[model samples]
Target: MQQTTVAKTVTYTGIGLHSGKSVTITLHPAPINSGIIFARTDLPGIPQVAAVAGNVTNAMRATTLESGVAKVFTVEHLLAAFYAMGIDNCLIEINSVEPPVADGSSLPFVRLLEEAGSVEQEALRNIIDVKEAQTIRVNDSFITIVPYDGFRITFTSINPHPMLGVQFGDYEINTETFVKEIASARTIGFMHEVKLLQDQGLALGGSLENVVVYDDETVLTPLRFSDELVRHKILDVVGDLALVGRIKGHVIAVKSSHAINTALAKKIIESCSK
Candidate 1:
């Protein structure tokens, strides 16, 4: 497959999950082989940061990327949207340090990208195929990548809360399926965890409108799907895997989070580069 970029610029504006600030983000087409880069438009000259696993500086509330003096937080959802749309080369220009939460799902971003339109690039795309099985685990959580012909993912999430108990989903990912099945699964949180996150000075802009908050027995808003928690995990895997610079292979994830996701991506890159 060939590399891809948008045909025209697109802009999105909303509230950030952290910092609670109003933000505007613009996506511009990048040249072939440019990869995915983030530009800080609010700064003096729009400093750019490459979206690589090594740039991940924090994984507490959400994944964050940092450069010398520029940093961006909670970018996974947007990245997932781009990955789902098969856009490999783009310059994401943002007027804030954090991207807009946009209903806590990638759907809005997906919509924005669709309106931007896409074009094929001249360069052939790269794929990191797993020739051997590799796994990473932390406690009961683990994720693995094994050899496969194309992109596929199976994921599970286990939370004791009745609304978000053990759940599973499996899908062969493509541009259509990613947008239809995964993009709208909002980032979920437990009511109990909300206080902790707030205490940590995170989720500053999170609310019923932007996140799926689960109490002991029910989600605060209408349930998107019974297995949305797992689906969101799948969404996160797509976003996290985008750090590898290309989409390839199958991934099986069990209770994996940002930390394990990044670790696995790095491992795959290191292994394939050998």
Candidate 2:
């Protein structure tokens, strides 16, 4: 595959899930080998932060990138969209700490990329193929990567709630299949933890409309897939690993969180060659 970038520029606006404020982000086609770069349009000098594991500064509920004093938070969903779409180079312009929640799924960003279109560059694509098996463990959760011909992700989500129980999904990562199978899976949260999160000043823009909520009885919103939670987990993993540049691996995870996902991604970055 040749290096790729968007054919046109596109922009969108939405509320930041953490800030509870509106923000705008624009995507522009970039030159070959530019990788994914984030520019803070709202900041002086328009500080730039390269989207990579080395720059990953936070993995709270989302992936955040920081360079110097510049910070871009909650970038995983957009990164996931870029990864699944086979985008090799692009510049992301952000007006705030995070992008719009946009129903708390990657679907909106996928739509943006689809509308922008993709163009193949003259340069050949640089990929980091997994050459060995590796695993990272965090408490009871773990994520593993093994050599594979194409991108594959298997996710198992474990929730104590009876409504969630144990659900899992295995996906072959591709733009078409991703859109139909995983793109629309929204982020989920439990009702009981809302107060705690609010106390921590998190999930400020979250609501039933943006996040799927699970009360003790059941899920508040209708599920797009029976295993949507696991699918979303896979989506998160794909997004976090986008920082690894490019890869061919079969990733298996058990109850992985954003932190563990990023950790696995850092390992992939260390293991693979540019």
Candidate 3:
């Protein structure tokens, strides 16, 4: 398959999830083999950071890419859109440390890319084909990838909340399925954890409009899917794995977080390099 890039420039403005600052990001088409590059327009010299596993310095509640003093946070949602849309190259220009948390899902980014359209380049895609199974485990949480003809993910999310006990999802990732199923699934937080998260300097911009907040008994916000939490987990997996190039494999994740997800990406990078 040939590589692809956005056909035109498109921009979006919203509030950052953690920083609580208004930011704007513009997406521009890039040449073949460029992958995804983020330019920090607010910094001197407008330093650029490549979206790669090796550049990931933090993956606490969100994925952060850093090079020197330049840093971009909460990038998983936007990257998930690009990966699912089959966009091979893009230049993201932003004026702040974090991208907007539009609806706390990939849908808004998907809409932006849809508006920009896509152009296929002459170069073939740089696909990382998983020839064998690889697994990374952190306690009870784990992510495993095995050889597959196409990109697929089967995810399981386990939560102690009564309203969100255990959810499972399996999807063959493509533009159609992604837009219909995964893109609208918003990130979630629990009512009990709100103050703690805020005290720790996280989820500062989260609201009912952007996140699905759950109380002890039920979800405070309406859900796009009955299994939205697990779907969002799959969305995050796609985004974190985007650090690697296009992948043809079956990813199986259970109770995995950004750290585990990116660890799997780094493992794949190492395996591919050998």
Which structure among the candidates has the greatest lDDT?
3
Candidate 2 per-residue lDDT over residues 126-213, each given as its tens digit: 8888989989998899999999999999888998888888998988999888999999998999899899988988899999888989
Q: How high a TM-score does candidate 2 get?
A: 0.97
Which residue pairs in candidate 3 collide? none
Best by TM-score: 3
1 or 3: which has the higher lDDT?
Answer: 3
Model 2 residue runs over 4 Å out of place are: none
Candidate 1 residues 1-274, lDDT tens each?
A: 8999999998889999987999999999999988889999899978989988888888766888999878998989999988889899999989899999999999999999899999998989887777898899999999999889988999888877866668989999898898888899988877788778778878889999988887877778777877888988999999988999765678998889998998898888888878
Deviation in Å, model 3, residue 48 alpha carbon: 0.5
Rank ordering of all candidates by lDDT, starting from the highest: 3, 2, 1
Look at candidate 2 and give me any clashing residue pairs.
none
Candidate 1: pairs in clash = none
lDDT of 3 by residue, 113-156 (tens): 99999999989998899999989999999999999999999999
Whole-model Cα lDDT per candidate? 0.88, 0.90, 0.95
